[model samples]
Target: MNQAIANLASEADRAEALQLQLEAGETIVELDPKVIHGSFVKDRLDGFTDPKFIELREGLKTSEQIIPVLVRPHPDIKGEYQLAFGHRRVEALRQLGRKVKAIVRNLSDEDLILAQGKENTDRADLSFIEKALFALRLDQQGVRRQVIMDALTITSKGVLSGMISLASSLPTELIEAIGSAPSIGRPRWETFAQLLADPSHESTWRELIRQEQFHALSSDARFERTLKSVAVRKEKVSDEQIIKTGEGRKIATAQSSKRAVKLTIPTKHTGEFAQFLLRKLPDIYEEFAASAANTTSDNE
Candidate 1:
């Protein structure tokens, strides 16, 4: 049994190695970075300023590029090529104004995505959300489920469906705003998705992320803050209560929630009652404040 397992593992290793092996007459050659374009379905969210990307760029400046990126002859453009994998390497080389070492092949769209996804799986650098978004983009382009599964190395249809659903639940603008929360996994993302089910909460999240202070935070911090903000908002609001008189007659309705309180009196004397309440509000508030201070002192 152990021998059989070893043989199977050996075959799997060989198969993976074969993917990077050169075909009959294929050879690695230097190509201008400008001529190599990104894949149709993006799999990464890290930008040029991302620390890891910057580290990659700095590392490339000191050592030779050991692996060649894969590219295919552009189907639409005559001389250009499209990148199947090694986007980060290509970007680093582009920034350095150096030629990219690549293996050019004639790959169809499906073939390209498969290669791209395989590289991502092997590297395992893509965050859960990035993979989810990548799967969503592939699905959006009408790629077959099997192809997406193979590309992402997903074994179960249920897992793939959940990923797509999670990505679809979020707004693209919101996701981009938060960036790729690398440390965040499915559970937190699912929790955030649940919070967003309320349309008002979704709106609040959108508006909160738009603020300058929110944008200043790191991607993971932004996600954490947003989740906490939404949760706090959820906790602050409670069911509206009916304000009644001593005899249990409903006189008004009061609704209170985070930062605001509203009172409604349905009687015809609403205007006069409102004026009377307005006149008494200062005294009522003063009395409440005095009581609150006394409670605090007693607690102390």
Candidate 2:
């Protein structure tokens, strides 16, 4: 049993013991949060407004940090360390005005993401959208797909693509504005992605999120309401309708809109009919003006 434990990998060996040691086999040490900088910050936070995060700070206040966070010397700044993972711990400690016990290492960008991803696996804590967005950010940083696959534990390119799609469904700024909806899962987030395909939905989101009422709701409720608004809007528009003549020939395509009527006349057998309508435009305008003038006179 003792030999088997010793043979286990460093990560899985004895996290308690392993976490107590740095990658260089040194013991964990305390560092000031102010001097610590964020590198590959894992959590997409909006001002650390999470109740759970506050819980973390409270927990740490009463106890020792069970998991040692990883940090490295600041690549540019002298005498400062940059955090690779465990951003929340750093943040909470930063707020508490305390030093964090961190494992110092010289980690590359790849090493940082891998370390963060491994820690994530141990916790399995990030929400689906968060993970997807993290994956997307790694891609944006020019990390290799296979390296991402290994770090994310993604099994297939297909799954990776799907996550990327979900992450990119909304603009980054928009998602940040709404905050991370922890209660939101993958299915609903995927639905939200589809809702954003409409340009109007993208435009309307800017308005909806600006409302005080929108901010009053819980994160999950905000996500639900925003997605539902888009869904209802899509339901209202029939999108397109076809008009067929008695002979079963296609006459026109009707597009539904909230404030306008749009019709498309095909150029096949309908070309002559379309020309005839163009010829009547002047008369059509005259009749429309006369009808409007009479209505104005009647109102007076």
Considering every candidate listed, which one attains the maximal lDDT? 1
lDDT of predicted model 1: 0.87
User: TM-score of model 1 relative to the true fold?
Assistant: 0.75
Taken over the whole model, the C-alpha lDDT of each candidate is: 0.87, 0.78
lDDT per residue for candidate 2 within 201-277, as digits (tens), equals: 67678888888999877777777888888888777766678899899888998868776667789888789999998
TM per model? 0.75, 0.73
Q: After superposition, how far is residue 277 of candidate 2 from its true place, in Å?
A: 20
Local error of candidate 2 at residue 48 (angstroms)? 1.2
In each prediction, how many residue pairs overlap at the backbone (N, C-alpha, C within less than 3 A)? Answer: 0, 0
Worst 10 residues of 2 by lDDT: 5-14
Best by TM-score: 1
In candidate 1, position 104 carries an lDDT of 92
